[model samples]
Target: MLQIYNTLSRSKQGFKPIEPGKVKMYVCGMTVYDFCHIGHARVMIVFDMVVRWLRTSGYEVLYVRNITDIDDKIINRAIENGEPISVLTNRFIDAMHADSDELGLMHPDQEPRATDYISQMQGMIGTLIENELAYQANDGDVNFAVRLLPRYGQLSDKTLDELNAGERVAVADGKRDPLDFVLWKSAKPEKPAGTLWSSPWGKGRPGWHIECSAMSCDILGEHFDIHGGGADLQFPHHENEIAQSEGALYGKDRKDDDAPFVNYWMHNGHIRVNEEKMSKSLGNFFLIRDVLKSFDPEVLRFFMLKAHYRSPINYSDAQLEEARAGLVRLYTALAQPAPKVLETALDPNNPWAQRFAGAMNDDFNTPEAIAVLFDLASEVNRAQGDEKQLLANLLRSLAATLNFLQREPTEFLQAGAKDQAGLTAELIEERIAARVAAKQAKDFAQADLMRKALLEQGIVLEDKPGGLTEWRRA
Candidate 1:
């Protein structure tokens, strides 16, 4: 049985699917105001590994991550840029998807947008209102009365008074209680917004917290097997979702008398840059695309998993190069040619693979599992002769262990340095071709001078192995 460190339970609980063979999962997605960063990549890759491992263990997973295109940030951005909300959100979403693809994150089975489920959100709010768990304030804003909900502090372990004490209670005279959070916001006359929904209350947009609740319930039912997100959203975000959904969904669909939202709560740790958490305010932040420009996505993925998923990782260039070299070692082991045919079966004597599986079985300990892979790779590199079969087995088994290592050994072995050299070689080849043409024109002085210059510069031309002039650094 697999054990997952559930955030809500605050314990590593044995994972039992709500339904026998299927895993229902929903991961909170990007807000679409800006491009995805390494922080987002950490969550995406972590959960992806979770999903892959679950599938490997013979369970079907249904994953849903939502797109929060409608929110305060999106509205603020749209107004600032003087662009339509759709235009701004669409551009950012495209960039976000591109980053996700580059990072090798699997697309969720269903990626519902918040705008598509306005009616569902309003209906849930209506249910909350009717149940006296929520109310529409005099200002036409739908608010979740956290004080009215039973065990309101269960998820975050924060009392209603504690939350109110921590936060500067905004002087919204419309709300009767300080703990009540917005479910729907009434549009103000001064704000020029692009999206509007017609509701019994008034004209307004769905609150940030309401979108996920509505989207999740519409697709995955009142409850799911797991609800995952970054650790930062544990407070008002996930907390409010639990209260609103339980009050609204469980009441409507009495069959799910237990919980209205999710069975398991998984949150990935933060991404730091040199021991400081990457935040815009701290100026220690990087966009995913910018990071990818300097390093391969696989290397980034590998660096992330080096530490446990729930533990913070402080990234730096040195750490990245270390990961790059480590990945190269694995690929080098894979590249060694094998004997004619080898049995595909696991070697009962191969303790390395067992170690890998053992680590993985222990709550997806990827760092230890990776250590096992590296150990096997070292053994493979040290072996000669009929070790081809061993290398082949490693090539296959490592893929099962690390999804990022799906490339053929030779392809994967090419480091970023080599790719840079290849580009330089291409330019040199163009220079050589131009030089050859110059020589063919019978400009003896230019040819002699060029040939001498080439020899002086360490470009020793000879009958090369591939019948093409190849050059290597001296």
Candidate 2:
């Protein structure tokens, strides 16, 4: 059984879904105003790993990651670029898919876009209003009445008084309370025409918090197995989701018959840059495409899982290089040709497999699980004959759970880094040919010089036994 740390409970707890043998998970996804950054990548990859593990653990998983396509950021970016909102969002949505593909992310079962769920959002807002948990302000904006929900700050572990003292909430125009968040934003005369949707609160769009509440409940019912996002969203975003979702379901007058909104809440830690939070405003954030220019996507993914999901991961060239080397070692073990070992059903009872499961079950402790992989890889390297083949198969089988080490080892090794210093597959091959010619002529000095030159360009050349040489980017 898996024990996940529930953000709401603030402790690790055994995972039990509302339905036996089934899991329905909702994760807050990208707000598509620009290219996804490393932070966004963590969210996508983390949840992907979770879903993979759930299915591997013999449960049917229904994963839904919602896209916030109609947010203020998307609207502003579209206006700035003088394009339609759909045009701006569609471009980034495509970019996001490309990035996810490059990172080897498994697509969620359902990707619900905010624009497509407007009717559901409106209906939920109306329910809140009727329940007196939400009200239309004097300015026509509908806001959640935080004071009415006694457990408003439960998810964040902050009482209303503590939140008020520790953080500053701006008193927006027409809001009854500073802490109250908007459920529906009333349209302004200066706003773009298509940005608004007709609703009981006039022509305006749904607020960010209500979008997830509506979409998750609509798809997964009033309650679900897991709700996850980055730790940054633990405050107002997720806290408000808890308020609205639970408030709508149970109403202001709580009933014993009402079910809890989400059974478990999970959050992955942030990706830091040089020990500081990575952010665009700080000029420290790295775009996924930008990073992929230098490092292999698998290297990036490996770096992410090196640290526990709940722990902060630092991003730097040194860290990525280290991750690259580690990945290369894992691939090197798989490169050796051996007799095919019979594929067998995954046995959790296997000693190494049990260790892997133990680590994974204990709150998805990837670092420890990865250690098990490294240990198995060592056994694969030392053993021979049938024993080695069995170990190799076990290594591959275990790695598949985390979605790693599936590619042919040579393919990964020779794939090299993405375009760097004008190095291309043709250019590297040409250099290799020159080096081979020098060696064939017995011009040892010239051969050594050619090898040195390629090495200087971050390529490592390996001499094989059959007058063959292999090269990979270092």
Candidate 3:
């Protein structure tokens, strides 16, 4: 009984896949012209969380996240770099994968590149034109006839006139209406060969909006369970996707088989910095690799998931430190040794697990679900022996559903912050040995001094029975 906030309907609806126990989801993925920014991190992590939860709920999921390898931005970036479009895009695509791997994102089931699906895009455009839902302009650009589709602005919840009024730019020379968008753009003479594809409408490339429509339809069919992207795409991008996909398949006909393009539309909120919107012009844009230089990748992922996916999250060093501290506490509990734990799947009988499920079922409310994790951590800390092991096992199991707490607790706890170079492992161990010797020799002052010195360097020392000492970065 999972409920998803369907953006198309503007309400949370019970999720029922077109095929029972199977979900076909398509997310608009990165346009690999440049390094991925923090904004891209949110999209990658948020949808990844969704996919993880669906599988944990026992639903088989086929997640398709399309990459826009060919676009206006890609073409321009290649020109700026004085390289072939393939080289420019391939470089960034690899960089994107590296970043995704750092963030621990699962590879999508089908990562269809816009460039590879040129024929599929052309076929959809051809159908749109034949159905009178699109037109070939005088300039040879085939544009979707937004006026022909009555539900043009349904996803955005605006009428055509209202949408047209909000437009800042006047109609272009070849467009029939100001609201009309290109499905196929006529190739420019100066554009590189890599950017152009031969189509029925002459040599050109797929429009940005049409890329998702064709890729999703070709991979997941016309009507799928879920379609998602960032909230900024809700207006022109996703709305155009609806128009293109539905118009091509159903056309402007009567009420015959009124199946929508997608059953659910999900959009995650934006990432802001210091309470202001993140943008390059404002100098707040951060590259994922650059941020990873200072903070651990897990810390970044934790920071991204700390806030509810639909709620805007403000980014700052202070915010990241908070996320790091919270993760540390959980890992600290997990680092403790315990007896064998037998639990595997989430236990319905466990109160904590039930609460976790309820939170996840309610529109994937991660904030509430994460709160349950902290509660489980508390129980794990308070319990003893086998009870402690069971609770700890449950905590890890539940966290796995959210893709948290998968790494070795020691690995995560000892990794320390990338920016911190205060105490090396060798130095920490040497100090621990010195402190142990000092304690053994009854030199109380020297032992206290060794402990204080290590503490000063952000290392916390915990003395155990049988004269064993353990340390972790603070």
Candidate 4:
């Protein structure tokens, strides 16, 4: 009963998988020329949330996120680094995995590298050529004929004339039309050695857009349930993907065969800093590894889920600190002494769980769902005895769907910022002991001073009913 916002339809619609109880989804992944930035983080985290919710909703998902290992960027970067294309791509792919692991992203069911599927791409391009949807230009490059596909701009909601007039489409020397995009690029004499592939269109490589069309159809089938990527790709990249995938099917003489390239399209909004887009060219981008130095990985994840997936999230130190503080509150509630919890499965019948599911079902509205988590936390804090234990278990179960709150509350609460030096556990225990001694001596002022000192070091102390004290980092 989950409804998602489909970018193609430009509205929220009920999700119905092509198969009854299974979903086949393809998401455009990183280009892998450099380390992933915060923008890339949003794509990974957003789709991860979607997949987790789908599994929690009891549907089998075949998630395929493709890798662009043989793009122009990769070639140029390898040239600059004075290394082979394979060496450059493999190093960045490993770095990307490390970043994904740190962000708690589940590995896609299939990660097809573009370079590994050259044969399939060539075959698809040949099909388009036979169908007359694609043609080999005078320069030996094969380009998709955009004018032949009447629905070319449907995905981006822009007409061909609009795209052509808004920004002057550079009519490449050999292209017949200005709007036509290359399906295969011909190798140039000045190009690097390993960059070229023996293709039907001469020794060249696949174009940027053709890689996804070939890989997605080959792995997930010509038609799948969902296709996702960043909003920046909505224009030429995804629009061209739809054109090539569908145009290859019924070129020119179009028919309603009830088969489309993809059913639902989902796009995560950009990451902004001070009302400007976060990008390397703007010098405002931060690498995932660099951000993890100051904030916990879980804190960064929490910060992302705080906003709706489609909404742009502004990154700043203040926002991250606020996220850490909010996460501390949730962990604090969980750290309360209670009986052991065994069952963690979500019970949709439970009223709290019902509210949470309702929020999640309505277009994956994470902000609303997160509000339910806060409300549950408040309930857990207010209740007592077995009631508290039951509610705490429910809180953990719900958070697990979002891929967080799995850590022991005390451990997470006591752990300080990753790169900063805070009060150590031993030092904190000593301070607590000194404060206890001061209290026993009736030196209330001395005890209060010790308490303030620990608080200043980002530590919070709680006095239990039986003269026991608990300490956690704030």
Candidate 4 lDDT, tens digit per residue, 1-474? 899999998999999999999999999999999999888999999999999999989899999999999987888888899999998989999999999999888999999999999998999899999989999989988998998888888888987777772353456778989899998999988789788889777999999899999999998898899999999999889999998888777777767675888999999999999989998889999999999988889999999999999999999988998998888888878887532544446787899999999999999999999899999999999999889988888888898899878888888788757634556788789989999999999999999998998788788899998899988887
- The TM-score that candidate 3 achieves is 0.96
Please identify model 2 stretches exceeding 4 Å from their true place. 165-168, 255-258, 338-345, 420-453
TM-scores vs. true structure, each candidate: 0.85, 0.94, 0.96, 0.96
Q: What would the C-alpha RMSD of candidate 3 be, to one decimal place?
A: 1.7
TM-score: which is higher, 1 or 2? 2
How well does model 1 score by local distance difference test? 0.77
Clashes of each: 0, 0, 0, 0
Candidate 3 per-residue lDDT, tens place, 161-251, comes to 8896245433666888888988888988988887787888799888898889988999898889999999989989999999998888888
lDDT per prediction? 0.77, 0.88, 0.88, 0.89
Q: Give the lDDT of residue 192 in candidate 1.
A: 65
Model 3 lDDT vs. the true structure? 0.88
lDDT of 1 by residue, 235-254 (tens): 77898888888888554333
lDDT of 2 by residue, 26-118 (tens): 999999999999999999989999998898898999999999999888888999999999999999999999999999999999999999999
Candidate 4: which stretches are off by over 4 Å?
Answer: 165-170, 338-344, 419-421
